[model samples]
Target: MKIRVNNDASYIRVFNATANSDKIDVYINDVLVFSDVRYREFVPYTPTFPGDYTVKVYECGNSEKLILEQELTIAGGNVGTLVITGIMPKLMLLAVFEDPNEKTCESNAKFRIAHLSPTTEPIDLTVNGVKMIDEIPFGKRTNYAEVPIGVYDFTIEESNVESEERNDGIRISKKIELKDNKIYTIYLIGDVPDIEIIQSLDIITYMNK
Candidate 1:
């Protein structure tokens, strides 16, 4: 799958969410950027100049077999993530970006959900029993929402399920703490009945400067 963005000076990284893929290498404009990236792993953000470029992914050590090729544009002073998702023979690239204009204060945090589970039903995310994100389907990502910095219970439930029938439809339940001025992505990965929740910090490099 290919993705095109408007050009800028950006910080980008790669996440391997392909449940059935082997270790891979990622190249930006033919230059190796991430190598030996295993499933469920993340390659940290790297700086890039503002421009358009090609992104190619290959099975580790096999340049002759191209797995996927995509087009990316670096947005100046922003941060983004390029995700490799889905099973082989039907792989895709998903671009998730942080809004550079949404400023955060020291008393609050920001978070969003990324649904990467290839076979799971559309779902809802509840934080401490309050619905925060709703009806997010496979391969869809939600925009960041601000919340007070604190510990909370996060639950993932199949969307549209009756409240009384939620026991069996619940997919993930976990507790997480959010810190002041931080950003997070809650990733729902793996296949149904065997799902996993991965919480990762999203650092906006341009803001750190």
Candidate 2:
């Protein structure tokens, strides 16, 4: 939370983390104030006449350490865009090849990508620098596929196939960041009904579903 404090007084506010997770530390003006190896979703804390304060969050557990520092400045007045909470830096996106071996998609499967970015609309959902698809079927034949990102270079996948003889046919490639509270989908239609899932990831990281 960002705050603006004036006068020689202290301001009290709630400060909490996921606790016992991202061991957090509190500091004001580069002066260390408090540190907790626990998680508190909304614990209270007081900052003394702060000019510029920061909340440093560090990752704990047997895994690697992830450090995040958020800045806050105090003034006699309120600051604009002072994000209170509910802001996520990263999120998980599920990419599924719907019914890879199903009869509805025996030859080719339709794709429908939806980016649940606060709404049904997307930030940037473009294909081949063209317009967007109105809708895609969910599960039935010629149905749309679901995805997370909007900007897709399906031709990149096409090029991958043309440049090399791929048994799976046309391929697609895209790189987009996933937003929290959003679901992206893709609608696809082809001659082949069955969808074949092929994962060639060099590194496999298991996520705790």
Candidate 3:
């Protein structure tokens, strides 16, 4: 006898001893699908979801019933990538906008930037050995500024320079020569600014206003 089942899950087929045998016993699961037993071969009955199923064959002499069986299953599959959203990080852009009018800090608006660490774990920043802000919120941006004199590279959190990927992070800003007397204003560019949290040392202009 020969039998075959399809992955499409449509149905199962059963066959018997000789090429002429047409009887069959078809079952979807263990339950008999047909009301009557087939002699030579059989065809499946109902439609079903993807899962294991059993098929059986039966032969009855006047006293006992004989049985044959098979198992089957149906299936479907799916796959894709991942996307994420959160707060922004600080970005340092280099720019020279001589506009004296744009000197004040704009508190109403805040921008975000994402800085990647050269190393996985947070870098223990030391500018002559000092501790800065320890927690850098990734994918998010936020900052507050207050400073005086000299160009600063390693950002000072409280008493130290800490490395971070957050808004208050190390950024290569426009090389502004922090002149002793003159004030410089910073402006952002692009629908999507090359950098997010832009900082400028235009204190003289801001104070005069």
Candidates 2 and 3 compared by lDDT, better number: 2
Instruction: Please provide, for model 2 over 1-209, each residue's C-alpha lDDT reduced to its tens digit, 9 standing for 90 to 100.
Output: 22333455443343331212345544444444555544323233344453666654434332234354666565532211111121233311112222212111222222434222211111222455553543322221223433443434542222223335644553334544323222223322121222211111100011111
Q: Quote each prediction's TM-score.
A: 0.87, 0.28, 0.23
Query: Which of candidates 1 and 2 reaches a greater TM-score?
Result: 1
Task: Give residue 8's lDDT in candidate 3 (0 to 100).
Answer: 44
The all-Cα superposition gives candidate 3 an RMSD in Å to the true structure of 29.9
Angstrom error of the Cα, residue 125, model 3: value is 79
Q: State residue 164's C-alpha deviation in candidate 3, in Å.
A: 87
Model 1, 1-209: lDDT tens per residue? Answer: 21222345566889998888899999889998889999889988776777788999999999998999988776576577889988786788888887655556778888889999887889999999898888999988898888899999999988978888877785689998988888788899876677888889886512632
lDDT scores in order = 0.82, 0.32, 0.29
Candidate 2, residue 80: the lDDT equals: 14
Model 3 accuracy (lDDT, Cα): 0.29
Q: Of the candidates shown, which would achieve the greatest TM-score relative to the real structure? A: 1
lDDT of 3 by residue, 1-209 (tens): 11222344332122221221233344446566553443222223233445665654443221124244445443421000000111112112111112222232332221112222211222222222343334443222223222344554443221123435344533323332333433432222111222222333322242234
